[model samples]
Target: MSEEQREAVLDEALDAAHVDAAFADQLFGVVDALDTSVALRRAVTDPAASEDRRSGLVHALFGPRVGEGVSGFVADAARRRWTTGRTFVEALEREAVRAQLRAADDDGTLEDTEDGLFRFARIVASDRDLRTALSDRVVPLEVRQRLVSDLLAERATPATLALARRAVAARNRTFDQTVEAYVDLAAAQKNRVVATVRVARPMTDEQRQRLRAALSRQAGRDVVVQEVVDPDVVGGVRVELGDEVLEGTVSAKLDEAKRLFD
Candidate 1:
């Protein structure tokens, strides 16, 4: 892949790895309700509208109950750029993740289940045909929801099934995103920042504790770490924090070295 494409993919991977659903949605219902708000969908989606002004309009549009954190993301993104219908998705995703993280906590009991949920999302996202089919707007919401339920039956949580339905009915986003939204919600309920860690081997308790401490400091909150072993990583550890990744694997370093000679 080209550098920009690779970077975008990495960003998505990191963001997906670091965040979860319940937290991502919170007041997100408000953002989704925008189209339902009024004829303003025309004003907000208008290509001619100034980005800053469209953003300002949202403050009066959604109200303080939209809350400060969600408002920050929506307002800022609007001020930054006028998004096309497709690009408007960018701001929504950002708001979702930020809101979710703010709601996460130390117990984070749902971390593993949430991880499983997103893993399923990535699996669906990898299949082009399946991804396209699930995201198709032409399909009736009821049909699409049933289709996803049949596809994931016995595999996804009941809650997950509901989210798939909602994404189709509400967001018009892909199935993968629906799964991701649920995971975000699960994580937010726990009130902790999700950290995906790739280690050369399973981490010892001490190792996990120290790592969590460092990450907690960086994130400004308790950090819940998920451990995955990648022997090919050779040595060191890699941690994904939000859109950033801290890579320290021996294989990665060696590959960098080889690239230098090439």
Candidate 2:
């Protein structure tokens, strides 16, 4: 199935499970099991197997091992059609992130988690050694997870830590990419889009509000502004919402003008 179809399936499971904070650990456990064993992943997600057979495989493997909610989720997931075992595993990971977001929302710290993740991503992006440590495949997974724990122990929420640790375990994406993806998912959970706005200086409250309103209208969704102070912008602002970047900075305009003259 396509990614959109897979997301739809996940949405169905999330709604049915009434996913809460506790489900995050359960989903993590499922992902770990799949990550550690190719056989188990294939057994549960095998397309040639009947849906009932797949459901049975989930029950045989995880029914006694996991909670009722987790078992139900596994069975439901196994019953869905996936193009590959890898995609099935990815579906579980997405569910885990979604559940964690739901839990954060329940605890009234969704925004905190969201901001903490973005801040950590920025920190990693700037620190070459730290990014190398987290992304190093030669390092043991336990060591990487410990590094994440030590860094975020007192500085971040439990949800942020959980998501960060899990991002390292992503099969197909780099650690930073996974964390950014998680941030995007968290923003979507809030029915908002993340707009990274670069400026020469911080905006006043009025300016921030007006900019958010304008971006919201442009994006056709509620916009959450992640402010970055960048002196190189010189003047005006550069707004990045996903792949579409609106570069209104003086430097960009000057470069355009220079190119035209050239």
**Each prediction's whole-model lDDT (CA):** 0.57, 0.81
Model 1: per-residue Cα lDDT over 55-118, one tens digit each: 7776666656555555644555455333354345544654454434333322343454466566
Evaluate model 1: give its lDDT.
Answer: 0.57
TM-scores for all candidates: the values are 0.46, 0.90
lDDT of 2 by residue, 171-207 (tens): 7787777888888888998789998877767787877
Candidate 1: which stretches are off by over 4 Å? 1-113, 169-182, 198-214, 217-220, 226-237, 249-262
Best by lDDT: 2
* Poorest 10 consecutive residues by lDDT, candidate 1: 253-262
Which residue runs of candidate 2 sit more than 4 Å off their true CA positions? Answer: 234-236, 249-262
TM-score of 1: 0.46
